[model samples]
Target: MAQTATTGTTVAEVMAELAALEDPRIREVNVRHGDDHGVNLTKLRAVAKRLKTQHELARELWATGDTAARLLALLVCRPKAFERDELDTMLRDARTPKVHDWLVGYVVKKSPHAEALRVAWFADPDPVVASAGWALTTDRVARSPEGLDLPGLLDVIEAQMKDAPDRLQWAMNHCLAQIGIEHAEHRARALEIGERLEVLKDYPTPPGCTSPFAPAWITEMVSRQHTP
Candidate 1:
């Protein structure tokens, strides 16, 4: 493990460290996720651990135009420092699904403006923005369902989920699962929507993994929550 940098590090220094930690096999795996820099996640984490948290450094690193560095930026960024327009810029710069997912899941979801962004992005014309919106909504539903318009959310899913873009559909399906598992009052309605949409019905599930298909996923999650 690299020694933790006691002082602020520059983007150049972080890039140098990342270069030193590059591994071909790990890069191949990253490639599958649309990261071509071939930097291993373990190596990135090791470096990020050493770098600690430096919001300014994170922005500089993200500006260096490398996929792995951008990912590390998400790990170290100060979510509060990100204003709405900056986040919008970041979303525009997120050229691939992997980066988009990380920015939304790890960074945006933690921002103070998450709720506003979620509602706005869910309705955005851009698929990526809309996907992130739904993704954030899923997180909100799972973590803090208070004050959320659950019935309205379900109505949107019921009406538009079938025609939603692929990524949006996945997030919508996840939102349905979260509702079914966490909100007993809405579980039956969620299950009904799942049956009607039949989302991910034919999607393959890995052996020993629960299917993301809403009905099965809801049933499994509910069963686990009730167990013991």
Candidate 2:
């Protein structure tokens, strides 16, 4: 394990550890999802465990422009320490799916600016950014859907999901599945929209994995909720 300062560890040391941990097979698998890293997430989290919480170190690691490092940064960084605009800039720079997803899931989702960033990113013209927005919206759909317009979300998904880009379409499909699973009032309509759009219906899910297809995903999850 690398020695660390009280405030943080050196980026060089962390980068060295990451380099040693890289595996070609992992990188090959990650490339399918548009990520370029080879460091397994379980190993990466182990590194973060050694480094502990280090906001400044996280920033430095993120600045190194390495995918594995950025993933590590998301793990060790203090989420609430970031300013909203800083988080927005980070999102723009996170072009890879793993980094972007981790940033949103591990950082932005915990920030005070989550809702504000969600609104801004949702309307951005960039599909990748918009996907982040929808990702946040999906979280809200599952956890904090008090004021969200369920019908309106269904309307946009119905209107654009079929033609949306891959990432955006996936995000939209996830939100649709979430709405169907979480809100009984809209479950039938959610199923209807999913059936009509057929987004991700043929996605190649691994054995024992739930399909990303909205109708199947929603049905499976909702069934589990009702299981004894």
Candidate 3:
């Protein structure tokens, strides 16, 4: 791995480090996660720790066309440096659900243009863009829902969730749960919609994990909030 004395680590150095950490078992796991080009999360984190934030380096890494490299790019890219067009490009280029989730959660949601992008993306025809939009909406509702139109969001979920793409459906269901848990005024409506939509009602969850069905998940989260 080449390192500049002044600039620290370059993208090439990080790529070399990632190449060194490649394992067949790790690659198999990554393939199952929808990554055709694989590197383990542990190695990715190790590289990120060593390089820290490097926006320019991230851009270069993204261009290398490796799934792990792109995931690392999302980690290191400066949100402030992102433009809407660039974000759109990244979302389109994301080949896996894991990459799409990270790009939306880690990069797009933190950008200054998040709200505008969220609004535009939710209506987008591309399934990835639409999924990210709902995911962004869920994040906003969970944190600060100052000027958002909650009723409108609920209406959309109720109307479109049934026929939506798999990724978008998951995010929309999550958005419904966030509304029920975070906004007391909308809790009843959100739960009602949850029952009607029955989002993930039959989906299997781990033994100890709460189901992601909005009504159940909302009830659990609200109970926890009041318990302490």
Find the candidate with the highest lDDT and give its number. 2
| TM-score of candidate 2 to 2 decimals | 0.96
lDDT of 2 by residue, 50-136 (tens): 878988888988999999999999999999999999999999999999899999999999999999999999979999999999999
lDDT of 2 at 26: 94
Best by TM-score: 2
Instruction: Encode model 1's per-residue lDDT on 3-44: one tens digit a residue.
Output: 325575667777888888888887787778666877767777
Any runs in candidate 1 off by more than 4 Å, and if so which? 1-8
Q: lDDT value for candidate 2?
A: 0.93
Clashing pairs in 3: none
Write the candidate numbers in order of decreasing lDDT.
2, 3, 1
Q: What is the TM-score of each candidate against the true structure?
A: 0.89, 0.96, 0.91
Per-candidate Cα lDDT values, in order, are: 0.85, 0.93, 0.85
Write down the RMSD of all candidates, one decimal each: 3.1, 2.0, 2.1
* Backbone clashes, candidate 3: 0
Compute the lDDT for candidate 3.
Answer: 0.85
The lowest-lDDT stretch of 10 consecutive residues in candidate 1 is 1-10
Candidate 3 has its poorest 10 consecutive residues by lDDT at: 1-10
